[model samples]
Target: MLSLKKIAIPMLTLLLVVSAIGLTNAAPSTQAIETLNIGFMQAPSSTGDFGVRLAIDQINREGGIVGPDGALYRLQVVYPNRPPFAPDGVPDAVTSLVAQKAIAIIGPVDNRLAFPNLEVLAQAEVPVLTLATTDALTELDPSDNIMRIRAADRFYNEGLATVLIDERAITSFALIQTDVDSTEALLGFEGILVNRSLTPTVKIQEIDNSNLQADAERILQGAPAAVVMWGPPEDAETLLLRLRENGFTGLFVYRDAQEAVRSGAIPISLARGMMGATSWSYTTPTELGRAFLVDYVTSFNSIPTGVEAAAYDAVWILRRQIEQTGGDITKLREGLLQTPTIYAVQGRLEPSTYGGGDFSRAVTVYTMGDLGGPQLVARFANNVRLGDDDLVATDVRVVGLAGTLTYTPSPSPTPTLTPIPSATPSEVTLTVPQESVNLRAGPGTEYEIVGQLQLGDTATVIGSNADFTWLVINHEGQTVWVAADIVDVFDPGNLLSQLPIVQPGTNNPGIEPGQLSEGIDLTIEGVVLSPPQISPGQPFTVQVTVRNLGVNAAGSFSVSAILQPGNLTITAGSTGLGAGQSAIVTLNGTVDGTGSYTSSITVDATNAVLESNENNNVFPLTYVSDRPILSRIDFVQIPVGTAFDFAGGTADMIWTGTQIEGQNNARFGIVYAGAFEAVDYNAIDPSVVINFILPGSNIGTGSLIGFITAEGRRGVMRVDSLVGTALTVSYRVYSN
Candidate 1:
C-alpha cells in the first residue's frame, strides 16, 4: 500500500548503477590510496553491517576516492565485540576505534546500548552516524558531531499519530511502553494528537516481565481501537503476545521495534496483522532498493533490516563528503553540515544541524504479511526538513550572538527536479509477465487460488488493494486477483484510482450454516411409549416419529433405540422417503435393574444420510424403572453441624459447621423438596442444606436434604422434630 514519490529514472539505468558500480573507475590518485579507519561493533550480527559493507565494496570497486594530497583513500572497517548492555563495553569499543584513527562511526543500533557511548564519541570529536532512535542522542554534542541517519524517537511518534489519525481515522487507542526512553516517545506522540485539537481517550501503561499480562489486561479493559507500544524489541514482542492471548483484537502500532517482532519471538499466526513504523524497509520500490535486497539476501541468507539500510546510506553520504573534501576530515565535516540533500537508495537523504533535526525518509508504516515479511501500508515522510519552519514545537537554543557565534537559518537543500508522471483517466489493464501467475480469491497469498494468468495474458482491472500491491481482475466473470509486482499495468491514463480499494478477505468473511443449500433435511419429531414407567427387568415398547423436509427423497436410514446402560437395538426404520413425508418407527427395550433409563432414538444411525440439520435427528426418552419398595428409617440422635460418614463410608456429606461453605467444597450438602425415588433421584438438583440434627435439637421448619444413600441410590429425608419430643426422620430412597 505504500506509495513512494520518486524520480522517473529508467529501471535499467538504476540496475546498472547498482550492479555495475564496481566496474566504473573514479579519477586515479597520484599516491597510494590512503585508508580511512571506520569501526563497527558486532559486525556480522549488527543490522547495519550489510548495508555498510555493500556500499564500501561498491565505492572501492570504483577506484575509491582521491585525497587532498592527490592520494586515493579507501575505508578500512574495524570490528570490536561490544556485547549488548555491557556497561563499559561500548565506550571501550569506540575508544579502540578512535585509537585506530577511525574518522566516523556507523552504529550501535540499539538506543540503550548506543546512548552510553555518545559522550565518549563527542569528547573525541568523532562524528557518528548512529541508527539509534533516542532524540536526546543528537542533543549530546553542541557542535553536532552526531549526524543521525535514522529518525529520532519524536519523529516515529509523529509517524504513529499520522497513521492512527490521518489514515485509519481511529479516535481512541492504548499506549504501552517499556524502558526509560519510552516515556519521552509516548509523550511526543501524545503531543501530535493534542496539536490536532483531538482529545480522544488513551489508556497509557508501562509493561515489563512481571506485569506484562496484567498490563495487557488493563489495556484490553479500555476496549481501545488500537494499541501503540514503544520499548526494546524483546519487551515489545512479549507485550504483543500477551495482548493476543487475552483476545485483544485491534490495530497494534509498534514503534522502532520491528527487529523484535520480526525475530520470530511470536507465533506467525498471532504476529500477522501487526503494524509498525521504521526508518527503512526492505520492501523499497526503487530498482536500487531491489538490488540491495537481492544482494543482501544472497550474501547473508537473511532479510536486511531498516538499521542496515540507514547505515548503507550513511556510507554513501560519508563517501560523497570525502570525495568533495578530498579526504580532509575538517572539510568533510563542513560539507556534511552544509549539504542540503543527497539522493540515495532510501530516496533523498537529509540531516540537520538544528536541535533534534529530522531525517527525510524516516518512518514507513507496515503490516505483518501473510506470505512472508512485512507489507508496507503507508509512508509518513519527514515534514521537519531544514529551513522548513522547524514545524512541531522544539526548544531553540541560540549558540552565538552578534559579533560572536550567532543563530542563523541554514540554507535549504536543492530539491530533485525530475518531473513526476501525471495520471490521466483511461481504461486500466494488466499484463502477466513471462511466467504463469496465480490468481487468488483475495489480494494476499493466504487467499485460495482461484485461477491462473498465463504469460502475456492480460486482464481488465476491476479493483485493487489499498496498498496498490495487488490487482483484482475479472477472469471469465469470476473475481480473481494477482500480485501487482509480477504484472505490468497498461492503464491508458491513470485508471488505477477508479478501482475500489478492498482488503483481502473483506468481501468473503465467512459463511453461516443456514446459508448451506445442498443437503437432506431430517428431524426426530417425538417418541411415544406404552407405559413409560415399570418395575425392574420389565420391558417397554416405544414409537418414534421421523420427518424428511428436504426437496429430494431421503435415502435409506436406520433408526435405533440405545439404552443408557449400553444396549442398542435397531427399531422401526425407513428404506426411503419422498420429500414432505413422515414415518413412525417402533422400538422395544428391557431394563436389567431398577433405575431411570434414557431411550435415545437416533435417525440415520450410521450417518449415511446427509441431513441439513444433523443436530435435530436424535431424540431422548426418560423411562422410570422403580425398585422394590423399602421400609423407612427414623433418625435417633445426630449432632447438627457434624460430619455424617454416609454412602458406605466411602464419602462424607454433612453440615460440618454453621459457616457457609464454598461452592468448591465437594462435601457440602444441599436439600431439595420431594420424597426421593431411586428412579427419580438423578432428576433432583443437589441443594446443600442440613443433613443431620444435633441431640435434642429441634429440626428447623421446612428443612430437607436430598442425598444419595450408601446403596448408591438417591434418597430424601424429612424430619418432624420441630413439634415432636423425639427426632422423627422419614426417608424414601431410590436406586440410581
Candidate 2:
C-alpha cells in the first residue's frame, strides 16, 4: 500500500505547476536532454529494489521514459537514504521527495512499508507498482494509485488450499499458524471449500511463537492430517523444528519459505517437501524476467531476491505506459490500465489482454524443489473465465455448517510382520569337524593353531565360548586345546555354560518383568547364554525352578518355567537328597524355538503333545505341505472388565476342517467373546493349544478354529503359496 499523505501539500503544488505550465521538456536537437526523477523508495537492502534498479538502468541506457519528442528521460533514483525515523520523520521524508518533484513512485520494497509511501504517491496521483502480495491495498481503490504486479498474501495459501487437497490426497487440514495476518489468510481458505460446498475438517493449532513445546503439544493433539503453517519464516521454522523433533510425521505447507530455507534452521531435506506462493520469486524481472534470473545466477551464482521479477515487471509497466501513451501521462495511464496484462517476465502474460487490478493479481503457484529452488506447478485461471455468477466473491468466511467425517474399518488387513522370532541364537553346533583339528588361542578354527589333535583325540567340551565351540583336548604326548566345533564332538556339550547371563534387572533399561520399585539400583545379573527373541507386548518365556524340600500330593501338580530356547534345553529331576532336604535341580538341556520364549512346564501342562521324548526329533514342530494357511480376524469392541460371554457349554461347537497334516479339531475355537480382539492360528505360531481352561464366567468354553480354504498364502511364512500352496480358513463357534 503506497501513501503520499506527507507529500499531499508540496506534491499538490508540483502537480498544479506542471498542469499549468504544460512544460513538456522537449529534446534539444543539441542533446543533453532533461531528466525525470522517479522516487525509488525501496529498501536498498531489499532484493526487489535491485531488480527495479536494473530495469531502470537498462531503460535509461536504451533511452528511458521516451518523451513526446522521443528523447530518453533519464531517471534519478532517490533511495530513502534517511536514518531510522520517529513518527514525525516518516512524513518529513515523503514530503521531501515531493519537493524534489518526483513524478512517480516505484516502491518502498516491502509490503508493510509500501503503504506509508502509498499515502504520498497516491496523493500525487502517481501509481505505485508494489512488488508484494496483499490484494487489500488495491481492493481499497486507494486513488487507483496502487497497481500491484505481484501477488498479495493470500495468493499462495489459496493455491495450496486446492493443491494439497488434490495432490496430497488430504481431506483434513490442520491449520497451525501464528495468530496474525497469515492466520486469517489460512482460515480465509475455508471460503474456498465453502464456495464449492465442500466442508473439510479443519483443526486449528495456533502455535505460540515464544513457546515451541506447548505449540508442538497443541498441534499433535489436533491430529491434523496435514499442517498448514500460516506464518512468516521466523515463527514457522521454529515450529517446524519442534514438530519434527516431537515426531509428528505428516505433510506441511508454508506460505513464505525463502527465509525458512536460507535460515538453516529447517534442515534441507525437510524443506524440500515445502510448498509456497509468492508475488515475486525474485526482483525487477519482466516478461523476460526469467532470462534476467538466469543471467543473475550466471553472474552471481545465487538466487536473486524474491521481489526481483516484480521489480523487472515494474520497470516494464513504466516503459510500456510511457511508450504507448506517446509520452502523454494520460496515454501512459491508459496503458497501465491495460497491456502487460499477464505480467510475465519470461513470456507474455498468458492472456496479454487482461485489464489491470484484477488480471495483475495473476499468480503462479510453485513447489519447492531440491535445495529450496522454485518450480512452477500451476497457475489458476481468471475468475472471469468461470463466466458464471455462481462463483462467490474471494475472501468470504464463516460458513454455517462444518465438515463431515466417516470411519471405515480397514478393508485390507492391518499390516503385521512375524515379530522377529522370540528367539535368536548365536548357539550353533558342527555335526562334524575337520577330521584332524587344530586348537587356536581364540574360539575360531581359522585362528592360529596353538596346538594339534588327531582323529582319536579326546577332549572335554566345557561349552561354546561363542559362535565357535571352545574345548580342552588331549593331543598325543601333550595336553592341548581347541574349539569343540573344530574337534568334532559326537554330541552337543552341556549348554549351561551360557546360562545365568549378565543382565540388567529391575531398575532401568531392563525387562519390564524385572522393573521393581523406583530408586533402587538396577543390579545386573549373569548374562544368560540364551535370551528369547520375542515380540514387544507379546508373552515370552523365562524358566525358574525350585527343588522339592517338602512332600506334597503328586496327582497333578503344575510347575512353571520360561522356555530357555537359547539353551535349547529343559531339565527336571528328583535330587532325592531327603524328604526335608534339597539339591540343585540344574534344570538342563532342551531344543525348541530359537529365541527366549516363556512356556510353563506343567507337570501336566496338559497340551504337551503327549508324545514321548523321542518324538522331539521325529516332529519338526512346523511341517511343510503343498498348501499354506492364511487366517484373518475382525474385531468388534468389547467393554473392559466384562467377563467374556462365550456361548454356553450346551451349544454344539464345530471345528472347520484343517488340511495341515497334524492339525487336529480340538486345537481352536471361535467363541462369541473371549479375552481380546485377538485372532490366532497355527500359521503365525504353531503351538497347538490342545487344551483350554473352561471359563467359570459361563459354564462353558469357546474357540476359533483354523481350517483349510482356497489356494493359500506364500510360505515365506511357512510354505510358498504360489508354488502350489495357499490355504485359508473361516471359523465360527459351535457349542460342544
Candidate 3:
C-alpha cells in the first residue's frame, strides 16, 4: 500500500502555539517539501513538450500533492541537452537527472537512445515512462521500474504472424529488415519457426550493398507468399512501393513505424495494401479519445501520433503516482504497480509483468488501402509474448515482478458478506456438453471437487468469474461452478460484462483431458478454392478449415482434399486442436487438364474421429477450367530517349512516358532496357526483360541496343545503326 498520510495542520498549529507559550523547549520547525523531478529530453520541434506541459498543468489545477508533513510540492521539469545516443552522449541526460536526484525520467523517446539507459535508470531505482517501442528496454529492466507508454516490439511480430500466416494462410515469406537494434533483435525469429518444425517458411535476406531494388528483385524472384519489412518508416514504405511497382502481388508486413504513412509521407497509391500494427488508432471509440483528438489538433494543428498520446499518458501516470504516494518518491514505484487501471486518451492503462504499462492491451492492425487512407483490418487483444512461434525468439528477458516485490492493492474495504437466495434469483440456462464434468467448489479446477455433472445436463448459471472462464451454477441445492469452456450458455445476456473482475487462483486448469467424456465432435467448416478458375498448368489453391467442435479437444485428425476422377487426394492433418479451435489446411497444386473439376474436402474422412455430429465433416468445392490465351505482337522501332507518340498507333504499345536506360519508350505491360555492344546483353538479364539482339550484330553495328521483357510477352529491339538525325531502331513485340 502507498504511504499516503494526510496531516492535520490544525493539530500542528495548536502544538506550535503551545510551544510559543513556553510549554516546550524544542524550537519552531519548518517542514521541508521535496519536488518530484522528472527529466526528459526536449526536441526542438515536437508536440511532446506540449503534452507534458498539459499534464503538469492539469495536475497543478487539481491542487499539487500534499506531503505527510502538511508540506505541498509540485512537479519540476528538467530538460537535459544531451540525451543518450547523441554525439558523445553516452552518460545520458539521465545521468545529469540522477545527479539532480530525479525520481523518474519521462523520455528520450527513441529505442536506441532509451535502451542503453534502462539498466542505469533501473539500477538507480528511478522509474521511467518511455515512448520507445523496443521490447529490450523493459525486457532487460532488472527492477521493473521501466514502463513503456507505447506497446512493445514483440506484439508487432505477433500481429504480423497472426494476420499473414494464421489468418491469410500465407505460409512462405521473406524478411528484409534494416540494420537497427530493434530489427536486429527480430533477426533470429526464423529459428523460432524452425524449432517447432512449422510449415510456414521465412527467409531473411541480407541487404546486398544496400541496393534495395537489387535485393528486392532477388527476393521476389522466389515469389514468396509474403514480404515482411522491418526498418525505419520511410525505408519500409519505400521498399513496399518498389515491390508493388515491380508487380509483386504479395502481402507486406511491418512493425509500429506506421506514422509515416499516417502522415501521408508516402503516397497513398504506392503505400496502399501495406499493413502494420500499432497500439492506438485515431478511430478508437471513446469520449476521452475523441476529446483528446480535438484538443491535440487544436493545440498542434495536426493529428496526434502514438508517441504524443503515450507521452501525454506518461505525465498522467506520474501524476497519479505522486498523488497516491503522498509525494513520496520511494513509494512511487509501488503506487504505479498497485494503482487501478486508469482510463487514458489511448485506452485503459494497466501495469503488466512485461514492464510496459499497457503491454497486454489490444493492437489495431492497420493497412493503407484503396480508400486513400489507413483502415483497420483486424484487432488482437492479448499480448503476444516474445517467443510464441518460429518468427519470434524465446526471450529470457522479462520484467520479474513476482515473488520479490510485494504489491499492496489500493484500499477498498470489503462489505459484510451475505448469503444468496436459493430460488434462482437470476438464471441463465447452460448445458454441459460432456459427461462427468467436475463441479468444483470454486471456479478453478484446483479447488475441491463438489460433484460431477453428466453429459447434456442443463444447469442454471447464476454468476461467473472475472474472465468469464468459469461459471457458478446451482446443482443439487448447492452452489457450484464448472469450467465455462465445457458448457454452452444459452442465454448469456450481460453476464459477462456485468461480472466483477476477480483474480483467479493459480490452479485454474481449463478442462483437462481425463475430465471429458468422448462423444462425437469434428467439423469441416469450409472448403475454399482460390482463383475459382485455373488455367491449365497453373497452380490453384485449396483451403480447408477443420474445427474441433466437441466438448473436448480432438487429437491427430487428418483432413484430406479429394479431387474426383482419379481419386487424387492431398492430405494434411494436425497434431491436435482444442475445442473451438480451427486448423486451416492449405494445399497448392496444378490442375493440368482443361475440364471442370469438383473437390471434396473431408475432416476425419477415414472415420477415425468420434464426434457429436459426424455428418457435418465434409465440405464441397468446385473449380472451373479455362485456357490460357497468347498475347498479340507488333514489330516496330522508336528512337532511344526520344519522345514518341503512340496515341494513334494501331497496335497497343500503350506508350508510357517513362524511358528505359535513358532511352527506349515503354509499353503499358512491359519493361525494356538498352545496352551497348561492349557489355554482354546475354549476361545482363533483368526480371522485366525477355529477349534482345541488334538487327545484325555480325555486321558492324554502330550501337547495339538490347531489350528484355516478361516471360508471357517477348520483345526484341535492335539498333539499326545511327544515320543522321533519326537514330534508326527496329523492334518486335510478341505476347502469348
On TM-score, the leading prediction is 1
**How far is 454's C-alpha from truth in model 3 (Å)?**
76
lDDT (tens digit, per residue) of candidate 3 on 651-713:
222112122321133322122333321222222234533322222222222343334332323
Model 2 lDDT per residue over 1-736, tens place: 0100100112112110121112234233333333455555533324565566555544443233445554535554444433112223335555545555555566555544554444554555455666646556566654666666665555555666667666556766566666444444655676665665655444454544665567677777776777777665667777777788888777777766655676565667777767676654543233234455654554335566556666666665565455435444455555566653232442223223543353344445566678676666555433211222312212111100001111111212211111111011223222222246665433444434656655443444323333433543323422223654333333211222432221111112212323232221111111122222223223323222222222321222232233433433343433232222112222334343322233333222332222222111110111111111122111111111111111221111211111222111223212222322233222323243222322222222133333221122111111101111112112222111
Model 2: residues with Cα > 4 Å off, grouped in runs: 1-31, 83-93, 115-121, 197-208, 263-265, 280-287, 298-301, 326-331, 340-343, 346-359, 381-736
Residues forming the 10-long window of minimal summed lDDT in candidate 3: 398-407
Candidate 3: lDDT of 314?
76
Q: Which candidate ranks first by lDDT, i.e. highest?
A: 1
lDDT of 2 at 38: 58
Worst 10 residues of 1 by lDDT: 398-407
What order do you get sorting by lDDT, best first? 1, 3, 2
How many clashes in each candidate? 17, 83, 16
**Per-residue lDDT of candidate 1, residues 120-156 (tens digit):** 6555546677777777777766666666778777776
Per-candidate Cα lDDT values, in order, are 0.56, 0.40, 0.51
Position 466, candidate 3: lDDT: 58
Sequence-dependent TM-score of model 1 = 0.48
- 1 or 3, greater by lDDT: 1
TM-score of model 3 vs. true structure: 0.45
